[model samples]
Target: MKEALLLQVETYVVDLLNKQLAATNYYHNAIHTRRVVANIEELASLEACTEQETMALKLAAWFHDVGYIYTDQGHEEESVTIAISFLKQQEVPEDLLSLVEQLILATKSEFKPKHKLEAIIKDADCGHIASENFIEISGNLMKEINAKNHKHISEIEWLQQNLVFLKNHSFYSNSAKQLWQPKKEINQLEVQKKIDKLLAKEKKKDKSSRFGRGIETMFRVQLKNHIELSAIADTKANILLSVNAIIISVALSNLIPKLDSPSNLFLVYPTLILMLFSVASVVLSVLSTRPKISNVAITKEMIKEKKTNILFFGNFQKMSLQDFEWGIDYLMENEETLYNSLTKDLYYLGLVLNRKYKLLRITYTVFMFGIIISAAAFIYSYYVYFSV
Candidate 1:
């Protein structure tokens, strides 16, 4: 019966593969069908299966994926329908046809084999999965998967799956295990080697991710703080400027010209003193608030050496935007460089601020003493001019 069913299937398969199948994919074409049919017949011989059992196995194998003629999925149903019709047309017995239909339905990959014949055929269909030809068969499967599903799975996922199947699976017939088990073990090792590789790849990825998150946050926070502080310093400078400007304005409007008259000559010394101090105070105020930018632009070499704050526009405004972005990304990649730039900028800016304050202190000192001395002179001269 196995031999007779073999002949029948071989006959049906030749025509179906040669031309009958629609949207017929090369991956599941005649060669795969033929291979499945051969494996089924071979597995039956080992079981010494009955004629009806053998025919049902062959019939299922041929039509198992016949539904592929219509669509990639649920081809098992199509195979069952095709088998029942074929059996009926051939005047094959009704009982045998029912068994064949059951066998076809059982071939749904997720379904566990329920009968001995079903088990044998199922094992045979997947037999190559554990054999040396596994890679070749897998390629066929990948092609079929891509063609039908329009999805491409990564090599690692496909390898993991094949390893799981071969490791967890077994065939009842002595021939399958004998012929395929050793190869399956080898296949498992190959898959493991790949899995180890993938794991290593993932580790490297995680390391890069951590570095980026940590350094980027640091750069953003520190730069923001520095900018805020600079603004505060500028505000303080502006306040000093306004205060001294008012003092200078008052002195100019009332004191200097009055000293020009000889009658006010008695007022001269004191008034001169007042004018000088007020002028000094105003100069000191201006110096304290003066913006002192570097005379020369910082260069690419300076940035490379980390001798300048390339991330700051004050440092890089002379440079092009393209150069600035490159420098920033570099600073981002090296957290040490970013910190160094910020520290340098802060230290220099602090020095400049200190100088401004020092000058301002002196200016206000001169203005206070001059004002006191000049006012005393004005009073003394007024008494001299009136007493005479």
Candidate 2:
């Protein structure tokens, strides 16, 4: 019975989709249907729905947008009429069939949902509006609209529509808001940026007027230091690993076998010390190259006090951009003071880097010395044993 019902549903979709303009692109293709089904399934898991509720949710979600097969204007109502007729023919229980149609109608954006299932399906349908793909999907919709009517919208109209959706749209499900909202903001910003770019495609003023000499220098010096530090870390790690490998090879190949001899017992402690130091060197090498939390964060008081470098955005990701930009612009006008602030920041960072390398140098030196001294100790003890 279930097999026959699923088969009928599939056959209906295959025939209906081909005639629909909405089914042509990313906006309303089989992919959209598949995504709706996926979201409904996730909502079911999160809501702990019953088997009947699950079936109803999945069916309603799949059939909700089928109204696009008729016309875009009032497809919601048309979809309900079609869904009811199809379910009745399938002989799904009468109560279950009515619930499916209700779920479909509730998905219409203007409808006030009266149940949790309705809300879930409604949220799932429009959930993509807050996705990273929102802009791309909107572009596809714009193309479809223009192709159908051959009407081109003004740039202002496009921007206003984008702002409305960005400001007004909300994800009903917690998961959608949490995971998709951040990406959606990025999507909105992309369109906003394109609008900004259209007005300022070419520069009319001198480059020197737009940016200060020291500000440009800060960018260059900071970037160069970052690259150099990365290379140094890599080189340090390779040196440490190579030194340890040589110690381990000598130990395993030469010294490990002599541990079984009662006469060579004095060699035990030194051999153990050598291996322990080698292992410690390798571990420290890994840590030195591993990243730590960026040192970019600085307090507002630090900026106001001229103690923090306001040159990096990571320093003020929590601050209002307007405030940070104001402070930075003020500092930029006072060129002498700004360079002093940057010099201090670089000096402190250099101090930290110095401490890290110092510790690393010690670890490598100890490992190398321990291996050589232990090797000599083992040979000396062996010679004494044989000479005696």
Candidate 3:
């Protein structure tokens, strides 16, 4: 009669769990409960439990997680209530029904078992921690928690938590301790290995992130410096341009008309020399400030080869916006290509600055020499005319 009652309990709990358990209860589903039943049977046989004790254990295992169909919090107490109600309807004796309730409650993670029977059921409930598929099983539990709580728990974090639980936990039954302790140690090592690998990967990723930031900073600083220098070069060219323009205007308005007179013939050469140098200075200044137009159009082939810099407008100005956007996307996806393009941009900018500064230098030199020679020529022309 007791055997038939146990079978009824199993059938009822299995059906209830199948129909009512939430999909998110990945670790505490029907399979887990069935495994617990199997574990308790093996443990009971090894410990030489009486038929009554064994029957109570199997009944408790079947009902231990049924309350999870409704909720997870305080489910052990609910499980006990369900066990009592079911066993009473079966006309079970109060003594055996009470033992079944106690055994069900003993499976609570925080509960300390009072005797060998409680110990057997509790050990069975947590048997998977020593099982060969512990990692896969633990992963499912992690997934279940994340799904139910709507939060992410990384694998490394889950493994660390498992390691702490393993270090603190031990089987209550002597039979369980003797049979499963060695395998449990091996599972601990496996968890440690996984944790170590995850830590190493995180460390490498952090280092790479820092290095990438450093590269960005370098590019930012260098590009800013290049733009500033270019602006200064343009300013210098503008100054030379204004100065030479004024000199040419003054000569054309004040000096050139006087050169037509016979008495002013000596002044003609001096004035001509000044005018020629002023015009040359003006030309050089304009050249220094002029924008360089690139005739080489950026093609799709060059962009694909990573040969052209899409960041510089001069390189891509002639291309359609569609092509330019495609090039930009390609550049962004490739780290090496993006950095290379930036480096090339800086190098070309430096070259342009070098040419501008060189031209400005030559313009300043011409203006200075023109002023000195023209002044001396005027002095000589006046002395010859007056001494005669």
Candidate 4:
């Protein structure tokens, strides 16, 4: 009689789920409920549960997820209410109906099972975690979440979440632990492997992004340093030019006119020597400050081949504005070409700075020795002429 009643309950619950369950309830459908029913029956038999206990467990499994038809959150309480109402109408004994209601509520994720029956149902509900098709089952659950919540989750993100869940979950009953623990551990390792691979891929992408930024920073800093050094060289050259101009002007105005007199005869050679050194210093200084523009014309072919550096004004000065813009656009589209142009610009700028500093050093040396030699010649000529 009890077996006949159990059969009737199964038919009714299956029909109700098929008719009323939402289409998006992929993880909580009649199929999932049937799996739980089969799992519970196996666990009950393994644990040597009495006939009455087994019947209560089967009833609980069928009604556990039916509450999903009405709501998603706090569905365990709704499931208990639905199960008790249906069992009462079938003239179930009050004690048996109460046990079934408690068993349904025990399936709630937050509820801990208190005894053998509750433990059996709880383990049965999550038996797929140890099943051979765990990955497929997990994927279906993810799809159900996305469909129901109207959101999206990537495969890597889903695997990470599953890894955390697997680490935290454990079977409650001794029979379940013995049967499912080894397979559950294997599933955990599989989830971990997937997560590790995804993380490695993301890390590689991030590293490439950082490398590009680092290259840009290096170019910016080096370019600024080169410009500053060029400015300093130009300023030094200007100082030497002004000092030489003043010396030449004073020599021609004040000393050269006095050289025409016999008394100033000894001063003529020293005055000429001073003027010669001043002219040489002025020439060197001007050479240091002079701008040398490249005469090589940059054609469209050179730009396409990346043979000419469009970043430097001297390289592109002869090109028309339209041509220059086109070259720049091409460089922007190709990262390698753009970096090569920048490198060429920096290298040529370094060469220019080296030439400026070398000429400036020679100019300063000429000016320093010129003053010492001219002064010594004037002192010797004055002493000898006066002593005679």
Candidate 5:
């Protein structure tokens, strides 16, 4: 009966947490609560707690973080309140209920444990910080903090914060001190190593930016604009292509058949002229939108002279990776060369877009003139051959 009652309480806590905890509570959801419960079970065995003490500690672990669903601030007190109310509903002994409330309260990082049981529960709650998965768990904790507090923390800042936290944090239970303390120290050292590497990388980037930051930004913006204009040119070409295709289709189906009869012979030249202009327009439109591939062979000398643009695939499509990497490295090391490459890339893109638009313009002009001349020819033929 006692086992069944405890099982009921665990079920209720799991259900409540799953329902109340938002998706943004990435660290404090049901998974975390379950982990704490499992940790306490392990510690309870090692600490040699009595059966009643074990039950109370396990109950506290299950309920301890439940109040995170209600509020982020002063959640420990809310957790204690919830544990008391739930235990009362279960008709638990007053002494056992009070002990459970105390265990929940002891989980607050600021609160020092007043007894062995309290110490065990507190250490269990923080078991992940000493486990092999500390780094992954710590990342989730930071994400949860950011979501709950509406704060953004950089990787370096978070590592520094953990450094301070681990420095000050201590395991209260002898079991944790003996087993987890060494692992916790290892985690702290790894975090420090990461922080150092990140700092060095940032320093290098800052130094590199000193030489060509403005030029790089200018080139990036120009390249982006050129790409946008190229897209617009392609879209215009496609529109002309579609329009001319439809015109040719209609001329072939409807107008070409009429030319078989001598009575409709006057329509022959006009229809043929209309279809000719449309087919020509379509061919030009397709050329304007067609992707051009380079068939010319490139040599290392061209790359050395900065005449080849490694940024464009057509320029380096046939080059070996080693050669390409060497060319890229040379460009990166030389700020002037990098800027010149970007300039050439942007300039060539502009040239291509200009050609596309020029072709599209001619296509539209021919289409317009063909329609006008065809309508004039049709009207003149009708008046001369049939109107009289």
Candidate 6:
């Protein structure tokens, strides 16, 4: 008969919650009520609660949040009225029904739980806070709050509010406290990680707001200009290298063999001069385009200390995702450090550009001088040898 009554109450509450509760009351719907009942059963076993006490606890859990169907404000009183009506219809004993009412009222967070049964119900009501599903449950709560209250609290603010609530909350029963404390601490760590992420985002947004768009625009434009200039220098150097290589190849293939004959001896110095300049230009061009990278490994501590430039590939290419994320978080948290890293990136890029352009200039000079000097040498040789 007792098991039949519990089942009847469970079915009735599930139907009531499904049919009457607002869709927006996601965290307080049938699922939560069911979880509360399950939790109470677990606690009852651990604490060795009496058969009547267990039945009352389960009934209280079923009817605890039922008042949300009519109104959210002072829902506990409404829940008590509903529970009494249901118990009277079922012909439940007066004392057990009264105890169920007390348990239902004790589930309210603001009310201090007085009796052992009250403590069990209260702890069961918030059991998710110490469960592995805490994170997902918290998200549903946020969505529910947003849906009902129409308030758009930021994630960081929500986390802060939740952390305060958790800090002040405790499981009243020794069984619950012992079983849940470690898991609660784990949930707290998860909350702290979320808070850190939100803080990182806020810091990045604040930095952008403080710096204004003009500073960012200036860096972007200057960096683009530097990259374009480097590209141009590389193209010009490639052209010089190609032209000089062909000239050297033609001079060696067509003129060098002829130099053994006395009649073609005059072309020797001209061919030599052109070949020397062409080879030199090729070497310089290769040097300018050569890639250089540091193979040194960086630690997370270096990134935290702002000693690594996360903007450059060499600094983070070998690092793990966790370490790289930590580096990015550190950079995002500090505007000055982030700006300094960009500055260092730009400075190194400029240095590379300077080196490329300088080498390219020398290559162009050598090619131009080689053309003029080789033409002069050819002209004089033609006059001295072929004019006879």
TM-score winner: 6
Query: lDDT per residue, candidate 4, 105-127, as tens digits?
Result: 99989989899999999999999
Give the TM-score comparing model 4 with the true structure, all chains together. Answer: 0.53
lDDT of 3 by residue, 12-87 (tens): 9999999999999999999999999999989999999999899889988999999997789999888888888988
Per-model CA lDDT versus the true structure:
0.72, 0.73, 0.89, 0.90, 0.85, 0.88
Instruction: Tell me each candidate's TM-score.
Output: 0.48, 0.47, 0.55, 0.53, 0.56, 0.71
Off by over 4 Å in 1: 1-8, 20-26, 172-175, 194-388
Residue-level error in angstroms, candidate 4, position 167: 0.9
Q: Is candidate 3 or candidate 6 better by lDDT?
A: 3
The predictions' CA RMSDs to the true structure, in order, are: 11.9, 21.8, 10.8, 13.9, 15.6, 5.6
- For candidate 2, give the lDDT of residue 171: 67
| Clash count, candidate 5 | 0
- Tell me how candidate 1 scores on lDDT: 0.72
lDDT of 5 by residue, 285-383 (tens): 888888887876667688678787788898888888988898888787665567677878888998898898898888888878888987887788888
For candidate 1, give the lDDT of residue 202: 73
Tens-place lDDT digits, model 1, residues 1-388: 5466557766886687577665527567777777887888788887889876877787778877777776667878877887777768767888888888887777677878766887787777777766566677777787777766779888778878877876787875567767667877887787789778887777756655555667668756765765666566556656655765676676577755666767666766765666566666656666666665655677668877977886545667787778777888877766566667867766776666567656756765676666677777778877788999
RMSD (Cα, Å) of model 6: 5.6
Candidate 5 lowest-lDDT run of ten:
204-213
Q: What is the lDDT of residue 190 in candidate 5?
A: 89
What local lDDT score does residue 178 receive in model 1, on the 0 to 100 scale?
A: 76
Regions more than 4 Å wrong, model 4: 203-388
User: How would you order the candidates by TM-score, starting with the best?
Assistant: 6, 5, 3, 4, 1, 2
> How many steric overlaps are in each model, in order?
1, 0, 0, 0, 0, 0
